[model samples]
Target: MSTALVLIMTPGLAFFYGGMVNKKNVISTMLQSIVCMVIITVLWGIFGFSLAFGESFHGFIGNPATYFMMKGMLGNATWKAAPTIPLLLFAMYQLKFAIITPALITGAFAERIRFNSYIIFLVLFSIFIFSPLAHCTWHPDGILAKLGVLDFAGGTVVHMSAGWAALASALYLKRRNEANHSPARITYVMIGTGLLWFGWFGFNAGSAFGANALAVTALATSTTASAAGGITWIFFDMLRGRKPSAMGTCIGAVVGLVAITPAAGFVTVPHSLAIGIISAVVSNLVVEWRTRTTIDDTLDVFPCHGVGGMVGMLLTGVFANQHVNAGNTTGNGLFFGETHLFLVQLLAMVGVSVFAFFGSLLLLKITDMISPLRVSAEDEELGLDISQHGEKL
Candidate 1:
């Protein structure tokens, strides 16, 4: 059920993103997300899962040969961390994550990218960026894990990396021909937000790997953080003399979800509330700041996902408690007067930000060379839905 929940988020993402694009480009934008479900699944079964969760190689990545072609996944096989479940179940659950990370970046390049080129970049990102990060952060023998960096879910592996890659994509792709357009469908955004919020319980709680107290704690934290985030966003807007909007509410809730992801299983509900509030404000400010710049991140992916992930990771180091989960061997957060965990989390954030940002820029360059990354001016004027897919809203 958890696996199914996570899988639904990709389609939810499609709707979320599709609703935000120009009406003429809505189909193309949504398809960019939907395609990942097919592409990443095939890759994961073949070797993508191995590269992320197989035997660690010098703490960098998993050896692709270790779980090649799902060779060793028998009925009794189990991942070390998730002993109660079959290895196949864990693999499938993780696969949902791989599908969405690339899909998330679609928002940045929405309506402007060539579908074939985007697919190329997605494959490259899944292998080079997403897989290594997942290995380093999650695998017991991987570098960040060994360094005692704690990511209950995928704050780093999913949000941070996707966020950075989104920035790189926006920069490389440059501005869309018509960058200013009203949303295609506000109702779709609301529906997508509902699905994402509902599915997120499984995304966070299921990380406990079993039906346990930790899972319950994670579920509660996720709920409060998201609620706090949604309300805070609208409140902030009203304070600035802007009307509270459904769009603001939806974006705020999602930001809260992203912010609480890392700390959900490691922090108290109150701290989760703090994380949600802090992240929503920070992301809201960043989104405003982004509009002042020449950077054309169409949907503010960097502001919401990237900055939200960073804030969550840092706060995890600030508020994490061993009493919350005996799994935090790195010691308590800075709020408890322990400096080691916070410093370690800080270092990991810097390293990951640099790696994800620069690595993605290189992949975009390569992908562009293989196939033109952007559509021609004629095609752009026609809208992606009609030009790219020969369809329209």
Candidate 2:
């Protein structure tokens, strides 16, 4: 049940990203998101989940002890106040994280990559980069989790990792044809936004496991900030004399959603507002600034997910209120003036960004040995869907 929800959940991300690309690329766009579901799901079953959550090694990577489901999982609430779902169920849930992390990378290189190279890259990225980061950050006794960093769902594990990986992939892949001024599919994008907004409640609140008060709090805060983010973006667009485009509203809503994820369970409804506002500005600036550079992040993943993740992680430090979680014994926030936690949060963000950036670039360089990273220029001009898949939408 959980795994299915997890799988269904990421397709919404497809809509969110697809809508931002040109209609000519919309089908191809959705295909990338769907393809991630297929490739990552099989790999997760093969060994991705195992290497990530199976067993720890030196506070970094997992032992791959559970490879090919060779060993069974612990089956119960084996860790702290974590969920008590069956181990396989837990594995499946984590698989969603693995799949979606790669899916998020598409936002950076969408409408450009050779489907073959993209697939190979996803396979390599998960086994090498994503699995280890997840193991180190999310596993019980994991170094980052133990280091007092705040990430309720995946500010670091999913967003930062995907964002940085997207960065490396964007650089490694080089440019696509007419990559500039590639228009987005506003209708599909809006649909994706609504889907993301719906599914995100499951994403954030469900991280709580029992559907308790924290889940409620997370859901409420998630919605409040997304709404605020949409309005915030609209406020800016209107000021600039452009119509408050649907695309802008959805993007803003997404920024708000990303901003609130880490702090949802940690802070109150009011703190949610501050997080949404601050993150909206940062993400907006990043998307605008990064696009002007030579880097062709086909879809701007680094700015939205990467930058938004940092904002959320940092805000969690200032706004987190432990009174909300009497049971959350391992972590505490800087709210009520516990300023020390803020430094810890900053360190965690810096560490994640640096590690993801370097690690991703290394993976790209090594993978280049087996296959080229970018699509042929001819293929890019024709569109990835037709050139790669022999079908154009």
Candidate 3:
């Protein structure tokens, strides 16, 4: 059930992003998301899962051979971290995450990127960026795990990585020919928000790997943070003299979800509320700042996901309580007078931001060389739906 919940988020993302682009590009934008479900699944079943969760190769990545073609996943096999669930179930659940991470970046390059080039980048990112980060963050013997870093869900592995990649993509692709278009459908955005919010319960809580007090706490925190984020975003807008809008509310709610993800199982509900409020405000400000710049991140992915993920990670170091979950073997957060955990979180955040940002820029360059990353000017005016897919909305 949790796996299915997470899977729905990709289509939710499709509507969320598809609704925000020019009508001419709506189908193209949505298809960019839907394609990941098909592409990443085949990759995961082959060697993608192994590269993320198999025996670690010196704390960087898992050995691809460990689970090649799902070889050893049988009746009794189980992941050590999720011993109660079959290894196959664990692998499938993790695959949902891999599917969404690349899909999230589609918002940044929505109207402009070539479908084939985008496919190349998605495969590269899953194998090179997503796999190593997942292994280091979640695997028992991986580097960040050894360093006592905590990510209850995937602030670093999913949101932060996608956020940085979005930034890199915006820079690499430059800008759309017609960049000032209104959203194709605000109703679609509202519906997508509902689905994303609903699925996030599984995204955060299911990380606990079983029905337990920890999953309960994660679920509770995720709820409060998301609510706080939504209200705070609209209120913040009003404070700045802008009207409270549906778009602001939805974006805020999602930002809250992203911020709470890494801290859901580690912090109390009150702290989760604080995390949501802080993350929404920070992301909102960054979005405003981004618009003043020449960089064209079509959907503000970096400001919302990247900054929100970073805020959540840093605050986890500040508000995390070992009492919340015994997994906090590292120590209490800075709010509890301990400094070590906060320092560790800060170090990990810096390292991940650098790697994800720089590595993605390199991948974009390579993809561009293999095939043109953008469509021709004629296609730009005609719309990607008709030009690329031979279909229209």
Candidate 4:
């Protein structure tokens, strides 16, 4: 059951992200999420697992000494936290995460990239960038984790890093396609929003590693925050004498979910609500502000996910109560008057963002040296759903 739940979570993200894109590109976008999951799973077993979970090296990346399948891993317990479950199970859970990290970047380059090239980029980026990152932030002896960066889940590892990388890819894809500039399809966006909310229960609460108090509390807080965020966006829309559109409500829900991810294990229901509302307003403002600039963040992944992740991480520091999570080393969080924790959270966020952005950029440039990253302008105009995959919308 533990093994099944972890692997399934990434595909759940597929429904969430696929539905948000234009109807024409639904399969194309979802394909990125799905394919990433599978490819990462294979890579994880072969080399990624060793590179990340093997012996610690200089507090940066792990060693590749544990190479090959079923060798060092057979029947032996080579893990921490949960030993009763097979080491393979724990490795798969982490593998699902590695797969999705770069898959999430696909959203940024949605309509323009060559499918074959993206497949290549996915494999390389997961190996070069994500494996090291997961090692740095997740392993028991990881530098950031050792320094007390409280991810709880993957606010930094998944959202912020993907967001930064997504932005870079979006820019690198070179603003192709007239179709993307068209008004987004709200109906499709709403469907994506619903799936994201449903899957997040597993995404956040499941991080507890069991069905227990902290898990239950996280589920409730995640649920409440999402609801309040949707309602808050509605309220904000009403204040302007306009009815809230489906897109607005969904973005609100997404922001809330993103904000709650980091703080889920630490804060109470009320804090989740506050963080949700604040996140909706802040992300809304960010989207509006970003549009005025030259950065063509195709799906606004950075503002909603990246910005929301940052908000949630900082809010975790602010609202975190060690009473809730015994693992939280900082006994008193920001709300309890320990302000330095917030700074630490920001520092951690910045570190991950910088690493993911540059690391992914280097990977893409290497891929580009071998093959063009984006589809031709003519193919993009014709639409990725049909051009890259050879399928109709």
> Which candidate tops lDDT?
3
Q: Write candidate 3's Cα lDDT for 189-227 as tens digits.
A: 999999999999889999999999999999999999999
Give the Cα error of residue 111 in candidate 1, in Å: 1.0
Residue runs of model 3 more than 4 Å from their true location after superposition: none
Per-residue CA lDDT of model 1 for 169-266, tens digit only, reads 99999998788989999999999999899889889998998899999999999999999999999999999999999999999999999999999999
Residue 249 error, candidate 2, Å = 0.3
Cα displacement (angstroms), candidate 4, residue 385, comes to 2.0
The TM-score between candidate 4 and the true structure equals 0.92
Task: Write candidate 2's Cα lDDT for 126-231 as tens digits.
Answer: 9887888888777786788777666777888888888888888888777766866646666777888887888788778877776589889988999998988888
* Better candidate by TM-score, 1 or 4: 1
Per-residue lDDT for 1-393 in model 4, tens only?
434554554665566566666666777877888887677777878778878777778767778766455346657664775554567766776676677678777767777788889988988887777777777777777888777888877888778878888877877776655634443355556666766677677678877777789889888999998988888888887886878787788878878988898888888899889999998888878888877887777778888888888888888888988888887885557789897678778888888888888888888898999899888888777777888887765
Native-to-model Cα distance after best TM-score fit, residue 127 in candidate 4, in Å? 1.9
Q: Clashing pairs in model 3?
A: none
Q: What lDDT score belongs to each candidate, Candidate 1 first?
A: 0.94, 0.79, 0.96, 0.77
Pairing residues by index, what is the TM-score of model 2? 0.94
Q: Candidate 4, which segments miss by more than 4 Å at Cα?
A: 1-9, 74-78, 179-188, 240-242
